[model samples]
Target chain A: MKLSDFFRKKSSGSVAKDRLKLVLVSDRTNCSPDIMEQIKNDIIAVISKYLEIDTDELDIKITQTEVDGTTEAVPALFANIPIKNLKVH
Target chain B: MGEVIVVTSGKGGVGKTTTTANVGTGLAKLNKKVVLIDTDIGLRNLDVVMGLENRIVYNLVDVVEGNCRIKQALIKDKRYPNLYLLPSAQTKDKSSVTPEQMKKLADDLRDEFDYILMDCPAGIEQGFRNAIAGADSALVVTTPEVSAVRDADRIIGLLEANEMRRTHLIVNRLRADMVKRGDMMSSDDVVEILAVDLIGVVPDDENVVISTNQGEPLVGNDTLAGQAYMNICRRILGESVPLLDLNGKKGLFERLAEIFRKN
Candidate 1:
């Protein structure tokens, strides 16, 4: 019950739980770490053909999202890429 | 009208057979006509667990292939009233039956029994598909480990994909002492990851291992695991039975360790 331990972000149980959460999301969506990395590289290559994007700051993740008013949360793929410059068409 | 429930866990050796044997026997103990079907095929063992292995004459594969009638395949429990065991064939593999046949068999079983419990094979393969094809509901069993929990999560997802009516969870072989030491996943921790309705929590007990080894039916007893299965049966019957107070502090060794740590 130490105060320092209370604020510690990486308690053993929580650490395992967090890792499992990340893993289950990928499992349920049929996406793995390797697959996601490949996907990120592909998406970056396709998007960079037209625009100079900040690939370093780009983020791609699968998150739980509620659609409309449903009770059950479904996994939604989210990809946010910051654009540095856009080539004029 | 009866309920066909598939007792399944994605990973192997997470007490699926034990849960099926105990819950079916528990329901029969409550005076409900229950038939337990072992769908594991070649690796069948629910009959062994329920002590009905020696009595199985014609099994599931025989019944499905029309070599024998369904009634002939069902071995009545000599001890438990109104409980029956429809054993699987040891000679046949999982593909000996198909999901369509299982669905038909489940429909036929619903006409005569009050409850039909299917002991599903482990893994999400053809055996697993055949097992779940019949049941309207599911009970995902898991141990308190990361791998077991993850497998259970996938099972829940599969159940949802199949549009099963309901999916409940049973956390098995939980070591309360490890959870208290913050070294293992507790029941609450399991529920959080799986995101399913909680049916029961079976504390790790030597009684289970001993009974399993002896091929004896685990009826009501003072053991925590027995009580947990009883509670699960009650819940299945729509009764609001509370879970065991598995606080993890009552065991003598746990108490001694806590005292030493405090000193």
Candidate 2:
């Protein structure tokens, strides 16, 4: 089995696979990957001015979600920020 | 009521016309009355692929523009028990037809046939718009290449936007050997990227070329591409058909020929 596997060509290097992975995800989200990164950064910058967020532990994701009693699902963006301290007004 | 389905591919030359001919012919062979409308207008080719080219006396433009009755332009195919072709006008351009006219035509055809297959022209232009105007379902054909799948993705989005939710994918001209060697995209990759139900995967068979050259559809029981198309037609009727093996597995002929070698 190992010999046959070695003789077989690897499937990961096909250019189509990588390009499709990025493009399809971007398409489903209705935003390009670069735009997504820019949005994430702008969000972090705006929120960080008031509270100290754990930048290393921050998580941002765009996912598909089904709301209550809905016939179809909708795209939802979720962001998790670990707050270390809040600014005193 | 008949279902109007448009066979579309955003990129050209990915076997849209061939699929329309085979699926329509295959359905007809199943004793269902099927009508194939060439919506490509001046770039008509479904008639040739179905071997009904020379018989076209009237075309789609004639039917739409009131030059001829709908029945007067419908070319009946004797090869199949219940098949017909409504060829497109070779002189009139795509602008000659309108979406409203196509919708009205679809309504008129609903009561007359079991399946209405529209052969859509390539590109997301006026031709594509007019082809899809009357369709409630779609079959987007794509090759296993990046460009083809990308274009197919766009077409699927457009189909969904138009509320043609019953969309399926047909991956055409896939070379199984190349796929195994990791040189070409596999069927799974295409279905994953396109995110649609796969209706069929047509193996890259030389018979497709030969049949096209002869102005005939490849539907022989023993031929690989032909058998694949027959399977597609069966699935269109809501039957569960297993996909044909185009990979390294020995086919029936190869296994049977082994007996002769041993003898």
Candidate 3:
């Protein structure tokens, strides 16, 4: 068996879907890549004041999410921040 | 009073004009009085697409500028009894007409026709704004591609911003075989990404090109694309028509051709 057969490859359709999901989230929220980076940096800076965050593993992105009580999907900011420890004041 | 609908796509060459002509013609075939207004002012093609190019004496600019009456500028299609087309002005640019003028024109036409379909120009410019000025709803067209879907999302955002809340999606030029082979995005995938209500999905068919070149709209025909357009018209009329099954078997000619190629 070829090495390629060991790992399943993603179809082009799924690839397009994944890419469109990212692009459209940014488009709908009017958040450019630069704006996303700035938001990420600002978020890190603000959170760093009171706690230690793993900046390397921190992920911030705008995505479509279902509201609490409705089927309508809206653009939402999703941030995954791993806090190392809290700063003693 | 008639309902005014704008057919728009933010990107060019995504079948906006073709959808306008087909859907308008399809509605007319259903015995509804329909009027298709070409809003791509400087680059008018609806007249040609509807096979009414040679009959244009008074264009949209003439009616808007008081050079002629609205009735004088409306060209009746010979195929359908109640179908008409208001050809755009090829001489003047999009700046020649304002949103207020288009609104007045749409309001005037609403009294006469049952359905008024406006073929909007590409891009979110003054032309796009004018097309959607008096529209009660919109039909946004997009192809099954990354660029087309992205542009469609932007157009949907603009339509929502303008408070045209009743927007429908038409995904066109879909290749079924490619989708079956996992090469192209399916209609479900497109609707999932865009998050819009899908009115119809037109398969990629050579008959559309043939019909366009022949200056004929392919509704009430036996072709796949033709049936798709008719289904969209039914849905627009508040009928619950299920989406076309794209994975259906191919025609005899296509199957034969495939067999011959394999040999």
Best-fitting candidate, measured by lDDT? 3
Instruction: Score every model by TM-score.
Output: 0.84, 0.79, 0.86
Count of clashes in candidate 3: 0
DockQ scores for all predicted structures:
0.49, 0.38, 0.71
Question: How big is the positional error of residue B203 in model 1, measured in Å on the Cα after superposition?
Answer: 0.7
- lDDT tens digits, residue span A1-89, model 2: 68889767457527778667655656766787688788889888998889888888988867655688984445677788899999776
| Every candidate's lDDT | 0.89, 0.88, 0.93
Q: What is the interface RMSD of candidate 3, in Å?
A: 0.6
Number of the candidate with higher TM-score, 1 or 2: 1
Against the true structure, candidate 3 reaches a TM-score of 0.86
State the lDDT of candidate 2 residue by residue for B1-263, as single tens digits: 99999999999999999999989988998889999999998998998888888899999999999999999999999887789999999998999999889989987999999999999999998899899999989999999988889889999998888888699999999898888777888999898767799999999888888888887787646788999999999999999999998863677998889888999
- Tell how far residue B41 is off in model 1, in angstroms: 0.9
Q: Clashes in model 1: which pairs?
A: none
Superposition error at B12 for model 3 (Å): 1.1
**Fnat value of model 3:** 0.79
| Model 1 chain A poorest 10 in a row by lDDT | A6-15
**Residue A35 alpha-carbon offset, candidate 2, angstroms:** 6.2
lDDT winner between 1 and 2, please give it.
Answer: 1
- lDDT accuracy of residue A42 in candidate 1: 98
